[model samples]
Target: MVRPGQIYKISANILKSRLQMTIRASISCNGVEIADVTQPVKEGVPEILNMRV
Candidate 1:
């Protein structure tokens, strides 16, 4: 369980990091770019957060 202020701080940090990464993005392909890409990080996998498992 997380304390009141602790969770807020952790969540705030996560949002800040996510926002930073969003500002900086790169293409994976060298010669050609992929078409109809749903998600930037995970293409096939719908749940990118589940990659840890």
Candidate 2:
């Protein structure tokens, strides 16, 4: 159960941190650069939000 301000504060913090961080990525041997994660994520599974080859 969250308070009224919690969601706003949490979302704001996430946005702020994401914006402040570098977009540096790890590349696969196949030369694919995997980016952000998707929602409804499963534990022990990896999902790519964006990729560049």
Candidate 1 residue 32 Cα shift, in angstroms, is 0.5
Number of the top lDDT candidate: 2
Candidate 1 has an lDDT of 0.24
Candidate 2: tens digits of C-alpha lDDT, residues 1-53: 32322211111112233233323233334465333222333333443333332
True lDDT of residue 5, candidate 2: 26
Off by over 4 Å in 2: 1-38, 51-53
| TM-score for all models, in order of appearance | 0.17, 0.21
